[model samples]
Target chain A: MNDVLIAVMMIVLTIITYKGATLVYQRFRRMYTAPIILSTVAIIIFLLVCHFSYETYMVGGKWIDHLLGPAVVALAYPLYQYRDILKKMVLPVLTGTFVGAVVGISSGLLLSKWTGFSELIIYSIVPKSVTTPVAMSIAESSGGVMSLAAVFVMIAGIGGVLIHPAVMRVARLQGQIGRGVGMGSASHAIGTATAMERDHLEGSVSTIAMVLSAVIVSILAPGLTLLLL
Target chain B: MSKAVTIILQIIGLYLIYLLGTAIQHTFNLFIPGSVIGLILLFLLLSLKLVSERWITEGAGFMITHLPFFFIPATVGVMGYAYVFKGKGILLIFIGLLSTGLVMGISGSVAQRLAGRREKAHE
Candidate 1:
């Protein structure tokens, strides 16, 4: 199949799968039944039942992946629209992201070392909180498995989804923007989704936090690793 | 005629937007991503009131709302290493799983505190 044709088809399928899962989520009200999880399951089942090769899936799926960039870029409008709020919030957002990045790295490395895992494993584990593309790139550069980095990203997403609600409740944070930003900065996309569930402003702030978290961690992780080592 | 031309132009514009994102990432040596920079650029343009939000809102909203699904392709790529699943991968998975909670919980707390402080200072 032609790559462009495949990309178009995949785009259609992505839309269908996502929409279908969202409808189910609306009916069920379960995070476990969330659209992304369901859509991923649907795709995986389709692949397994039909025995489609990953490469074949990639031919079409890759195109949708290409849009990931555009989606990130598109987030700017919401962030921009909320710029006044953001200007007031910038110092805290920056401080929180940097501190979170540092703590996440330090704790991850310390825990891995204390557990007696190999250095290679620690190298892979420490960068897991960053977005997948950046984390994977760092993993590759630092000699961790790219595929493993992808798994780490998934784990991070799922972790964010499950725990962030309880965390927010414990903090007694009624401020939606703070709640959402915290979620996104830590969990990335999944956290951002949770934020969207709360409200638009929260979602937008979360998206900004998620993006900022990735950018900051990508720069800091390597330098921190060097200093720590 | 102009309506059709506008639609065509918008599609072209979106494509150019994506490409520009790629170019910036390559050029500026950013840690985050070129696409993200493109998003920031779009946000900046919107904030400056240079671009009409009405024009891009629909597409952007669609993308942002479904952002989680975007990771599927990359995650699926991980299946290629099924053969080595037992070795160190298990540990890697555990580490990933364990640390994510730490990352989100701690970061969320810290960010909240900072945002709160800033809010108070503003008052």
Candidate 2:
């Protein structure tokens, strides 16, 4: 197949899959239909059925990946829009995300160690609560596998979507800021997307929490790893 | 500005921020990702009134709404590590779920308390 044809096909297929998943998620409001998880599964199945090599799929996939940088930068818009709210809640937001990052990393490391996992696996899992780009970079620098870190990050996201409702209900977590910060710090982008479905305020708070957690974890992961390992 | 022009200009602005971030990362050897640096820079620009939100809102809104799509390729790339996951599947899932719950519970409760306290103080 021609490279241009392949690239176009990749982009088209991804958009279609994502749109379809979003529609299903909207209609059903189910965690399983969260666009990222659903589209990933759908694409994986399609590739497997067609015998497409992961490398070939990535030929066009890389283009989509390139957009992630710009998309992340675009997060400034929400941060900008909610600047006043952010300003008002700066103390709580910073305190919440910092605590959440510590809890997330400590719990992951403790659990992994309790289960007798190796040092590499423990390090990889430490940054799992953040978004993938930051998590992967932390994992690599900390002498862990980047691929494993990505998987753990996705699992954290999917788990957050599935588990948040139950946690919220039990904990009686009312108010947008509380719920949004919880989801974002725990699950990263997917959690933020899920929060976005609830309300704009929740989504905005989640974005802040997600971004702050990423920054905190990136700065702290290496030192923590050296201290703990 | 025309919508198309606004979108183009917004993208150019974002790319420029991203480039600035990359330059800083290379120079300082920061562990931070360039995109994140760009995000912080953009935030600073907006807060300082050096750049107006009107220039970026439409394009940024579109991108944020469809953010999950940008991650699909990377998520699909997880297939590359299938072999390593064979025996460790259960453990990884356990850790992911347990830690997610703990983080969510702890952060939510703490934030809610803090916000409630702040509101009461203001009142």
Candidate 3:
């Protein structure tokens, strides 16, 4: 198939798959059935079965990937809507994010070093907790593969969301702010969406935490990784 | 204006802001990504009343509500990196999984304490 024609077909197929996945999630009402999860799984499986190269998929997939930039910018709307609560509870939000950023970087750095990963892998994993685009940029500049860094961010996010309730109970974390900060700083957008579905307060706080952590991690990760490794 | 028009215009406005962020980043040679700078810019605009909420509300809301949709492409890319599923790649990801839980737990605990104390003080 020609590239542009294949691109259109791929894009259409992906959207149809995503929509179907969304309906499935809505029908099941299960966390594991989330649109992102189901759609990604379905699409990946379809590509593998069809023997489509990842590059061919990207000819169309990049269109969707490109929108991530504006989607990130759209985060400002929630930040604006919830500005009052944010101001009132600024103390914990700021401090928690700072601590989380530090912990996220140091822990990844320590583990990667202890396990004897290369410099490239260390840099990629260091920004794993950050939002996707920011993590990719940090990884790119700091000598890591952008795509690999993105995958690490996805793992951090999906893992954080999957384990949220368990971690909350184990850590004895209660209240909307605490829940929000945990997922936001640690999981970014994926966690924020999951948190939002349960409670708006937690969701908005997660957004705040996500943005702050992105900034903090972007500034700190490379320098920290370089120094430690 | 019709509903579709409003949504389209708002999205366009958002894209413009994103472009401006990129322009500034390129001009000044800043380290921050353009999208993030755009995020900050939009928030500042909204806060300062330079941009009204209605202008961005609908479009931004739709985008944020379905934020994960954009992530699917990249997530799918993982299947291509067969190198990552073996040996140390698996181990490295396992560590990432563990560290993610660690971040959420410790961060959650700290926020829980401080936020609860603030409420008690107010009470």
Best-performing candidate as measured by TM-score = 2
What fraction of native interface contacts is shared by candidate 1?
A: 0.60
Off by over 4 Å in 1: A1-13, A170-173, A227-229, B1-12, B81-88, B117-123
Task: Give the winner by TM-score: 2 or 3.
Answer: 2
lDDT per residue for candidate 1 within B1-123, as digits (tens), equals 465565445544555787887787788765656766677777777777888887776566666666766766755665565654487656655665567666666666666776775555533
Question: Measured against the native two-chain assembly using Cα atoms, what DockQ does each of the candidate structures obtain, in the order listed?
Answer: 0.55, 0.69, 0.70
What TM-score quantifies how close candidate 3 is to the native fold? 0.91
The collision pairs in model 2 are none
Compared with the true structure, what per-residue lDDT tens digits does model 3 show for residues A1-229? 8989988988898889878987897898766777777887898899989999889899999988888778778888887887887788888988898899999999988998898888888888889988777898898988998888988998888778777778889988778888999999889888887777677678888988988898899888867876877
Q: Model 2, residue A205: what's the lDDT? A: 81
- Candidate 3 structure quality by residue, lDDT tens digits, B43-109: 9999999999988988988887677787788778777776886976788878898899889988877
DockQ for model 2? Answer: 0.69
Candidate 2 Cα RMSD after full superposition onto the native fold (Å):
2.4
Q: RMSDs, each prediction?
A: 3.5, 2.4, 2.5
Worst 10 residues of 1 chain A by lDDT: A171-180
- Tell me chain A's TM-score in each of the predictions: 0.85, 0.91, 0.87
Cα error, residue B97 of model 2, in Å, equals: 1.9
Better of 1 and 2 by lDDT: 2
- Whose lDDT is higher: candidate 1's or candidate 3's? 3
Scoring only the second chain, what is candidate 2's TM-score? 0.84
Error of 3 at B60 (Å): 1.4
